[model samples]
Target: MSTPFSPRLIKGGLVLVDPDTAQVQRVIALQYNAESLRRELKGQESGEAGTDRAEPTRFKGVALETISFEADLDATDQLEFPDQHASAVAHGLAPQIALLESLSQPSSAQLRKVNSQASSGMLEIAPMLAPLLLLVWGAGRVIPVKLASFSVTEQAFDPALNPIHAKASFGLRVLTVDDLGFASKGGALFMSHLQNREQLAAKAQPVSLATLGVTGI
Candidate 1:
């Protein structure tokens, strides 16, 4: 029942997951108008021995650093789904709202309640919010990230004033070792994905020219 894979055909897109439950909450399959990828390096400036110029004496501040990126989501496809057809303007917005809301309210943990009476104060808090996981496998790279910011703009309302077309812009910060400490299923998977990516990158490196017989030039 599955179609055969072909290099000519492109497959897969951005995936979002609930960090607490490790469930695939949403998948963004449309082509975004724009997407940004950022990387940062940390270091200290040090003066050279006999020069007036100072150079950056860089070092890895964190074992793994976080990167941030922004992307836009649009609901303009008439063939998206039955509920997302052209006439179903409100329905077109449901999935986008669900995606954004899931990021904002991924999971909750219990906290100690404060009360005057000791016995009553010992109750646990109901909902302690947690973050969401963003996975991007585009550009021949696999990256696990955390949802940083999300904003949506609904436009093209129908006669009922329901949003028929909308665009959502969101930012994601790549997860690092610091963010993978949580013992949730998503957290564990995030860590494993990072490790696997690193391994694959290492394997793709070209060996030294000495390893080849034509290196005498």
Candidate 2:
């Protein structure tokens, strides 16, 4: 009997990169791939309801895009090997959950600095910025995004009330050159993502007008 063939799977992940140096700071890979991904796009039009009729269909820039998905994380398998996965045995999924939550927060050091400056009666302090975040789905799609929202539901817990199984839902707004500007690393990545989509669209076969029961306008 011959064995059936199985295709290789690629894991999707979120990566945090240093904005100035373009160095990867952290990588959080989803334990299980999302069952489905939802995406929405809204165009930036030049004309509004009361605007000029001319160039009504003109676009100011790339359309705003957003993506949402749910990822599942379980510590069942890790709990079996307590020696190696001691953290999972004790904290369950808390560490993993915290890692995701930290993406939206500034570093602890930054917070401390601000507090110190305020105590010293400093008039002004610079705003804190989070690391640049990248959503990598596959070889074909990688783009910068801002975490708009995040929610996690603890489904199962261990005897100690530690969450062992959970589902994390993420809402992300795709960042483009308009948001990041052409000089930024994220802006460059957005351009590459746009060009890749254009290339993919070009590869798609096109049908003539005859297919729609029309020869010419």
Candidate 3:
């Protein structure tokens, strides 16, 4: 496990965890960032019959919520991975690339089980393959996400072509219950996550007695 940035202050950042093992694989520190939350509404136009006037239905349309964030990474003086032998600045992009690549590959265990089942005519055993299919879905998942985009611009490089100074931007679209059906693991986790966040936020903000007592005195 990676140690906290400092003994006194806790380092905060994005954590990529293994879906199966629930192990933290990487932690990228939070820097300058922006979050985008979008909602889409749909409605039908209607008219009372003749007056050449149209109005939207009183009923509200379905709201689709999406959230995304862009964060910057600088490695000039920051050690992204202290345990590594190379210069932190020079090797900053290593973990980012590794995460992308890892996400692209499916889990070996899942694949082996799937292959084994197929070889044994498992389809005949369970044509729908309910339980097994669910497990196989998103095998080797590195953080439940619909999309992850990253771009790195190397401003400076060492003699060995390793980046010494660089700027990287990373973006993510979290997978929610809507994206991954409610039956799936990701969907369940997403719902639980929302509930947890809601609770935390509620607790984080408390009604201050000092403020209430000073109202309009």
Candidate 4:
């Protein structure tokens, strides 16, 4: 269907379009007057320039004589409505769509929740994915990534052992790192590294270990 409607120039020569259905609209004139143009530049010099918002711009004076039609868009494309006026087409026009609204700041909280659930599921399948990726990538000669990394780490720390010395290893839980670092400064690490049991018993300096003997009277 086609109909000729009156064209109106909106702000700054932007023509207003409200073609409800498919229709072709022809661009007419956008000219100005010669005397009005002369009056607009009367006080200025012959080579004067405008310095408003748009630099190097032409002024459409009161005259409409110098107007011309610019074929901005072909008549084949549908008319576009500004975003605020046209919002019903946002959700793919479907009721059962997952992302049900416009993608904006207000939808961020819901998007985050959906992403969180998806991430948890991805993590759960990570172990399976690792072996699959390794198999797909390795082609049977190479080992799986996780096991190979663990084996390599263990090989890097192969410690030396002496045959004559009976080694001792124990865990002593302490309160804090300040206390631990202070103890280390006073040779706690040197004493900790000492492995010989006979040497430890011979060099064990006696300081009365602090113990609070609690009794229910």
Cα lDDT listed for each candidate: 0.57, 0.93, 0.49, 0.23
| Best prediction by TM-score | 2
Q: What TM-score does candidate 2 get on C-alpha atoms?
A: 0.92
Tens digit of per-residue lDDT, candidate 3, span 1-217: 4577645433334555555455555655554343432323333345566665666555332133333444444555465455653545455555554554344345667678778889988665332211111111122222345344556576766566665554555444556665666776666766766676567688786766676776554
lDDT of 2: 0.93
Q: Write the per-residue lDDT of candidate 1 for residues 1-217, one digit (tens) a residue.
A: 4557645434335676666666877676544534555665344345666776775554323344455444454445654565646544555466656655566553332223222334566465445555455555555444566666767677676466666666666565666555566475655656666677678889996877788866777
What is the TM-score of each predicted model, taking all chains together? 0.54, 0.92, 0.45, 0.11
Q: Any runs in candidate 3 off by more than 4 Å, and if so which?
A: 1-12, 20-65, 78-144, 181-185, 196-217
lDDT of 2 by residue, 94-132 (tens): 999999998878879999989999999999888987899
> What is the TM-score (0 to 1) of candidate 1?
0.54
Error of 1 at 203 (Å): 7.9
lDDT, model 2, position 87 = 98
TM-score result, candidate 4: 0.11
Q: Across residues 1-217, which tens digit of lDDT does each residue of candidate 4 receive?
A: 3346755432111111112221222221212211211111122122344644442345432111111121121111111333542322232112111121121122555667667777778544221111011111112211111111100011111022111111111111111222234232212322332223346578887654353454432
Write the candidate numbers in order of decreasing TM-score. 2, 1, 3, 4
Count steric clashes of candidate 3. 0
Steric clashes per prediction: 0, 0, 0, 9
Worst 10 residues of 4 by lDDT: 149-158
Candidate 1: lDDT of 48?
Answer: 66
Number of the top-ranking candidate, with lDDT as the measure:
2
Better of 1 and 3 by lDDT: 1
